[model samples]
Target: MPSAIRFSGVSRHYGNVKAVDGVDMDIAEGEFFAMLGPSGSGKTTSLRLIAGFEQPTAGDIHIFGHVAQGLPPYKRNVNTVFQDYALFPHLNVRDNVAYGLMVAGQAKAERYRSAERALDMVALGGYGDRKPSALSGGQRQRVALARALVNEPKALLLDEPLGALDLKLREQMQEELKSLQRSLGITFIFVTHDQGEALSMADRVAVFNEGRIVQTGTPEDIYYRPEVPFVADFVGSSNVLPPEIMRDIRGVDAYGALRPEAVRRCDAGHDAWVRNVSFLGASTRVSMQVHGVAMTMLLPRGAEIPAVGSTIQVCWQQDDLHVMSR
Candidate 1:
């Protein structure tokens, strides 16, 4: 398969700061690829490089096998959907969607037709006459999406596009965005700090840290079988055990990682004292001190909730522990 975007040892330096340092990546055509990381981790900078908003200080970039180093954003077959929506308040939804075509000297009638189809694709067919202020946040987001789709971009770049929505609406839009990406069969490069969104929506994920990509793999691989302790700790706040804990628990000399949910309460297991308990409607999160180290585990809704300050025995599958070569 052709790569929708490729970065070969790309580095973007700002004299004293290295925003993107030697990033090598390949986003497959039609794949839902997620760049997951915290702020200052270089994920957003990577997206800007792909969007032609920034150029690499060193190395080459390719879009669908074409050299993209000297190309402008308008020359690339890609579009960016930013978190702000960036919609024009004065223009109607239809005209907003067709603005790109209008700038490219498209005919009024033809551009309107394309805008209508784009709006229909986002399930906003009848909202052509509505102003930006009249629509809800989610609706405005859809309008922004429709605007991007109007250009028929081969690869779409999303920079935390759902960051402004409420929890329920964000979750709903996550599903809708996934569905839209699948239907369009175009490359979708999503940049976000939300682990849940990346894990759920992406076919593959690249975890960024300190201006570098630490790991890239399927969600399960990134979650269950993390390469380093940082990936495990950042992705889901997994129990990142040091070398001492690893030797005490598993007779290993290296660092280790264990997911909270994998820790099971057992009567004849290692003794630990409950530090705190948090109810999350569907499950209970328990904080514990085991071997003088903090650990956390999620209990199902129907499971027994251990009171804080109580001693509990816990166990986990041997295979569930991921050993890291520190």
Candidate 2:
């Protein structure tokens, strides 16, 4: 399939700082693509560039087959839903969702009908007359989504659209957004710092840091086979074993990564003791010290919780290990 959005050697710099440096990526048409990273990691800047909110300092950005660098946001054939909603306080939900069409000289009756349909698509039916202040954070976000959807853009650029909601609401919205994307069959470029959101919702994710895309892959590939130390540490909180230990375990001089779930509490292997135990609803997170290195293990809820300070043996299969370069 053709790309919905492509960045060819794109960079956005401000004086000595590079907000987005040399990012080259393709977001396939109708795919749920995520740009994930921590603060100042350039994920948001990349999203802005796609939405035409920010221009590249170098190289080019393409929407579909057209160059979008010089085109203004309204002409880019894409719409953006921001974290803050950006709704007009004076306008009701219907008017807010129809604003884009109205600005484009769409007839009042037609825009209202389209806006209502969009609101229904977002499960905000009958909410047209409600003011932004009357709605909850999640509702406001849905209205924002409805507004973006009403535009019927080829792709949607979402910049932390769920960042403002509570944990439960955020999780709920995640599923809703995924469903919405599937139903619409339009490309979605979602920008978020939340690892859970990216892993759970995106068909493919681009991990960014220091203005560069460090890795891009499916959620499982990125989590299970990180190419770099940063990706291993960031994606799944995987334990990065020391080179000496890795050499001993795998007989190779390289950085090693082991997922918490891959760790097993064995009767004999390496002398270790449980240091901490965290009760996570479905699983227990056990922190242990093995050969002086801290390792985490996620045990099923029904499994015995290792007593803190009690010595135990921890082992993992060689196949479960991911050896990466420095």
Q: Rate the local accuracy (lDDT) of all candidates.
A: 0.93, 0.92
Number of backbone collisions per candidate, in order? 0, 0
- Clashing pairs for model 1 are none
lDDT of 2 by residue, 186-281 (tens): 999999988989999999999999999999999998899988878988998999888898877789888888999999877878787789999999
Residue by residue across 122-235, what tens digits does model 1's lDDT show? Answer: 899989999999999999999999999889899999999999999999999999999999989999999999999999999999999999999999999899888888899999
Misplaced by over 4 Å in model 1 are none
Best by lDDT: 1
Looking at candidate 1, the ten consecutive residues that score lowest on lDDT are 317-326
Model 1: how far is 279 from its true place, Å?
1.7
